[model samples]
Target: MGNLSRKKKKNKKEKQKEKTKNNLIDLQMDQENEKIQKTIKIITLGTGESGKSTFLKQLSILYSTGFEESSRELYASTIQKNLIHYIKILLRAAHSLGIKMQEENIRLSRSFFAFDDLTTQSLQAIIQLWSDPGLKEAYERRSEFQLPDMSKYFLDDAERIGKSDYLPTDQDILNCRIPTTGVNELNIVVDDLPWVVVDVGGQRSERRKWIHHFDGVTLVVYVVALSEYDQRLFEDQTVNRMLESLDLFAKTINNECFENKNCVVLFNKDDIFRKKIKEIPLKTCFPNFTGENDYQSTCKFIQEKFDKIGRNKKRVIFYHFTCATDTESMRAVFDVVSSTILQNQLNVGGYL
Candidate 1:
């Protein structure tokens, strides 16, 4: 009888211990949920190919577990599509330049160029045409026409993409050009703070959809390609790309919906700009300016151009020169951005 009483007391003590442990776990989970609820939403805004997606990829690589297998497969498909697009661009350039091709090559290029839909057979035809020596000659002469900056990258991979098994590497995926169609969001935990980074399409057609996302945005990261000063948009050749970016920046900051939002202006593609600026002067793009053809002067001039837009605004604008593909540089920049956002959040007495 005494032994039975002792067993009952021990069981009760074990039950109480279990209950206390469970309560602690529940409390911890509640606190974690609260932290998640207080997440910050950051929207990335930029012109097409201004490294928005690349920036997101860097975040995933550094913070998250990286993309899943399915996403990597999707990126592979994009690489194949990029190959086809590259071939089409080359064919169009050749046609526009009145560059004559061999009879067979011309026939293939014309058929592929005219096709509205691409099928397995059409893809095979593209592979064949891409392999021809005549097409190679045309590609070699691509400098005569205004090809995309990414054209050569895709062209070099055209043959590899036609293989039965082709997987895209992280670098290839980063370099691949797939225009964002709509709003894409990536959730990440940075410095124990839940962060939702949103990427939207940057084309003129895509701007209309941006209004819906401005309701609760905490910050805006606006990216512009510094090397685009001498280029024109692919959709509208008449519009100078740099001028278009400036106009877009002006409109974005001046928008009433985002008046209270803090902005980070990223002068992206600095690597390309550093190389190109030496060959092409800033005066070529902005005639009134008479700055030295060095990197610092040119970048300062561009920053001032953007700063002029925000002179009358009440919000704070932070500027960063970035090469989005460079992981180390982006990491440092993102750290600064994280600190700025946290400080702003505290100053505003809540999340912005």
Candidate 2:
């Protein structure tokens, strides 16, 4: 009887100990997980067609934001690719059957990943505000989310603010401007992962304003348009100014700039550039960079020249990209960006 009683107690003790160990493990796991939430805050920055939106959507769905789980957006790249493949088949099938098609209109959106809704409103309202002629010109010169001329825009509001004839419309954005501004930070993230995203990824020249919002970030993606290589837009002299911005961006954010972690390149319109190269004569980052050394017949040659000399200068591992990139190509490039997060973080802020 004594022996049986002892064995029962021993078994009970063992079971209790097992339960305690399991509980401890669960607690430890909960703590370990928050490390990712606290340590990393990824931000997206790029020019258009570089796939920032698609990639961001992927991330959002993967992580399962606004849904109780990991990204309720419910997407798998391969599945999406397959669906698109079938859609292409359908499109072709319809075309063969003498079916006419209508143009599909698209809408765009970005997030700020912040606490208040101000970031979202800031992006949307500022875009609306910049519609003013003079403000738009200033924004083109310096791409920022700064408030527009309230005097010109909110003439009545200025009067309500106890100020009459305030031609210097916005007192807020003007206040933020400072002389010692070699570096700018436009950090718009929340909980180190960004709950919202309000990005201005188009217009390579305006990419300069990117640094203005870089105080806090965990990841960055740069999108250089290969389409710009194949198709030249010479009517408005916008390309020249854009080239200037690219050169300056390259100069400031050197190779050593991004500590090699959480940064990647989306070479947009890569396929299109290949098909459209005839239109683009100058393939270099800056066409009028006035380099007596480098030639600009092709992108490969330009990258090669920059590679040899860019070694002494800022390195351009910037991938070639296209929104219309094939499945195989996107797979390769997407992996490249994902792996970059494992490298070192880039210098996402300041002039350099």
Q: Which candidate ranks first by lDDT, i.e. highest?
A: 1
Specify the highest-TM-score model's number.
1
Which parts of model 1 have CA positions greater than 4 angstroms off?
A: 1-37, 98-147, 311-313, 350-352
| Error of model 1, residue 149, in angstroms | 2.2
lDDT over C-alpha atoms for residue 13 of model 2: 100
**TM match of model 1 to true structure:** 0.76
- lDDT per residue for candidate 1 within 1-352, as digits (tens), equals 9999999999999999999999999999998776655778888988887888888888988888887778778888777766677778778777776767678878877678655434566667776777776666666554344555666666666666656577777667767767899888889988777889999999899999998988667788899989888877777878778889999998887888778777888898898889888877787679988878899999999999998886554578889998887889999999999887656765684533
* Per-residue lDDT over 156-226 for candidate 2, one digit per residue giving the tens place of the 0 to 100 score: 23222222211221222221111121222232232233233334444445556665555444454554554
Candidate 2 — worst ten consecutive residues by lDDT sum?
105-114
**Candidate 2, after superposition: displacement of residue 176 in Å?**
34
Tell me the TM-score of each prediction against the true structure.
0.76, 0.39
Q: Each model's RMSD to truth, in Å?
A: 7.1, 19.1
* lDDT on C-alpha atoms for all candidate structures: 0.79, 0.39
Off by over 4 Å in 2: 1-39, 48-51, 58-198, 201-209, 230-238, 241-245, 251-262, 278-297, 304-328, 340-352
